[model samples]
Target: MTVSNTRQQVKLSDAVQRIQPSGIRRFFDLASTMDNVISLGVGEPDFATPWNVREASIASLERGITSYTANAGLMELRSEISSYLKTNFGTSYSPENEVLVTVGASEGIDLALRATVNPGDEILIVEPCFVSYAPLVSLVGGVPIPVPTSIKNDFKVLSEEIEKRITNKTKGIMLSYPSNPTGAIMVKQELEEISKVIIEHDLLVISDEIYGELSYDSVHVSIPSIEGMWERTILISGFSKSYAMTGWRLGYVAGPEIYTKAMLKIHQYAMMCASTMAQYAAIEALKNGKEEMENMKVSYRQRRNYFVKALKDIGLNCHMPGGAFYAFPSITITGLTSEEFAEKLLLEEHVAVVPGNVFGSGGEGHIRCSYATSLPHLEEAIKRMDRFIKRTNG
Candidate 1:
């Protein structure tokens, strides 16, 4: 067959092209390829998936269980997730109808947005959030309105901030507790206040509680566990962080039957099903993984304390992160933009960290460093950072 005069110029979706690529991955791409690099950029656990969890996946694979599960997911896994959530946060979900397994919380975010949003609708995203929130909203033709939280307030999403953004076109809000980039977790009282705004505004919520278990100061409280938020909240969580199961790619979205049914429609079409072995592994994780997760959390707590102190000692303004594995410190003192600071530090000290501005507007002047690596690496990274800061500021 003769080729055309020119190869077909494929038309890309304007919606897809409209948003930018993830800022986190840019650092990862550079740092991952280099030798002698200590990366605090990726927000993933350093721990391996617990032996029991990995064994389950191995067992399933050994049995040749590579086929797709139900579109909604394995009923058994969903049931375990429901029971786990109820036990942890007192929120009840019907395994069959209310819980749908996803590829990860990433997929849950996409599925929830696609199901509920329409063009021109506004979704409230708390700033310094994960990079995907805004882009995902844009992909679904929903407008993302970021609500900024300050370091002074310890970065909790206040009800007042949320209320200020609630216009008639606002359809929902996206929240991540034990927030990415900042590691700020909302207390129950704060969530209660935000819950009131959610109720008064009659808004829906997409709560990403991927780091809920890693809260160092207190237990994580689910927004839906509060009165008046259940029916309207879509809860997204997963095993990637909690179980060190990033490779497993298993997560679940829980909501009211109506919203879940809608999400399932999207999940069925876009994903068809999550990984069968991963779903099976997640069931084992939910049943037996708490102790292992707690052990990992203890190590993280130690790292947080040591790293936060080290940052302060190095003359950086860093807030004590309450949860998750990241410490977001202001780099304004060094007189570098977040991207510049990150790139320079990577070049000078071979230490890679995420630039905060990539997360959203309010993230300017800050850098996010994940303490999820081993204590030794964190210590060395801090040493390198101290040297870099001194040399740069000097």
Candidate 2:
């Protein structure tokens, strides 16, 4: 008498359900299926991880030193990170208590938001940015507010723009300069302007400086180095881009004790610790990888210069990116939407690029092409893209 047949759909968490899959990944997956496809889509260094770093990892393995380190990460690695930051960016932190190594900078972003964001809290994200930031914020029950920066400002967020968006609900601001997608970077003066608004509003900042060492035109400014910013900024960086250590999955978060401890608590429960061997590699990278890192940087700068110039020569308008390996160029000349341009270019020219609109507002009518590959690949991609653009517009 009791059993009527019925099936109810299983519900996923609202955070998971609401967020869209990464737009960058969609193109990457498509590119993987095609042969001879020159992909300017993914933001990864083409260089192999430095040999010495690898050797360090190998030495550790040979020695059977594979046990887990402290939950906060190996103390030696943290100390190296502290020295690296201080020497390179003029930002200081206590290696003992302030730095927490995570799986990657991506995880640092997650821990930062989870530790700070409360239900209904707002986080201002400077866009066009890395694909992960807003989604991670939403996952933590924070409202991700896109503070869009246009090509006019070289994609740098303005103080007035930030001030206009600030409300009591905005708990923090997320910034990635030498930005992904756009490659826009803020100079000290520009950051100082934004810092005034941040300080006045009493907002915390999560500064993702993953590409800090890649700045081409000027020195990279660590936001925490700005007056009054150290107390409120969580500085996130890693060995991935700078040291060609992406697969190693190591990155760190450094800030005041209150915030660092909060993220550390989350890290303890979630990640436990970053890889022990990777930590040894990172120490090697910091201690002796400078020359190799600079060599890679010079190659990136060459690729960037060639690629950006090639885009402009092909009649696409692109601002010279100050840092990072991306060139966000306007595709409106082809009279196609960003997605249309990317799809058609992939289908027609065997070239893959991520459409700009996926990066957030103000990213429409443009496309993001990564110059992280070799110079020859970049040149070949540009040739294919040139053909596509001319064919489309003709």
Candidate 3:
């Protein structure tokens, strides 16, 4: 064999090279390898997939329904999702034209960006946002423009702020509420203001409402439900957070026929379909698992309350999350950077949390602690955090 250095000469895409590994994953990797580490870092709900939903999956398998579904998804699952959205969120869509089941909301996000974004197009993402949005935008040759929200404003983006970011290159706004990390949610009034900007700017909206079913004080409001917004909005939601089906890997997107058709084309080529058994389970979740979801939300609410109170008592500046199972607390009082606080807490106290900067610049002074763990683990983690803070400060 000839001596060749060709392996080192391989060229990689700019998009791939620019992307960074997720900050959230670093702590998870450390926690996984450590003993007795209490992790508040994971974003998944701790509950098992409800028994009925699980049974549905098993039934599909026993019935030999193991083949791939249509690229868009099984008609039955799409129909169920359409009906669920209409009845639950007051958003109407035709299953045939509007829905495409994806591996998860993660895939739906990537598909939407891939289908819509041209090189150098801009995606408006709110901070602190989900970790995946920026990288996914980059993967499709789009630039992610983050609009920072503040804890003082309850992390809601002002309409004026959003309007200021608009430019000729802007293609869409990626909105995730009951947001990951921060758990900040916008009420109908806030969304209406955002809707006005989207309307005025003629911008497409990618609404990630995965936490729609988990709100504590109020119901979620989808921008697409507002008149004039539907045509330009793609609603991305799934059973993962709400139905405790994270491991099932099932989600879908609903939008106008034209946009959805394009997304479906990309999804067809990329994922083909979501998991077959998981799709059946999701149908049951949408159709008959409302009570189960409600119960899980109640548990999460209780945990949220407990965790917030504990953080406050430990001298952490915490805010009550309106939706989702996270508490994003400012740790600046401890005179520690977000990453420093997280690393010290993990190594010294065996408690794990994701640094706020992992989400974006707006998350700089904070850390995200998920209350998705059991009550006992949450209590123990809080105690460990308190001890660590005292020892460090002293």
Q: lDDT tens digits, residues 234-271, model 3?
A: 98989899999999888899999998999988888777
Task: Give me candidate 1's TM-score against the actual structure.
Answer: 0.98
What count of clashes does model 1 give? 0
Report the poorest 10 consecutive residues by lDDT, candidate 3.
1-10
Residue-level lDDT tens digits of model 2 in 332-369:
88999999999999988999999998999779999999
Error of 1 at 239 (Å): 0.2
lDDT tens digits by residue: candidate 1, 1-394 = 9877987888999998788888888888998788999989878899999999889989999999899899999999999989999999899999989999999999999999999999999999999999999999999899999999989888888888998889999999999998998999998888888898898888989999999989999888998998888999999999999899987788889999999999999889888999998888898988988899999999999999999999999999999999999999999999999999999999989999999899998999999999999889988998999999989999
TM-scores, all candidates, are: 0.98, 0.97, 0.98
Local distance difference test, per candidate? 0.92, 0.92, 0.90
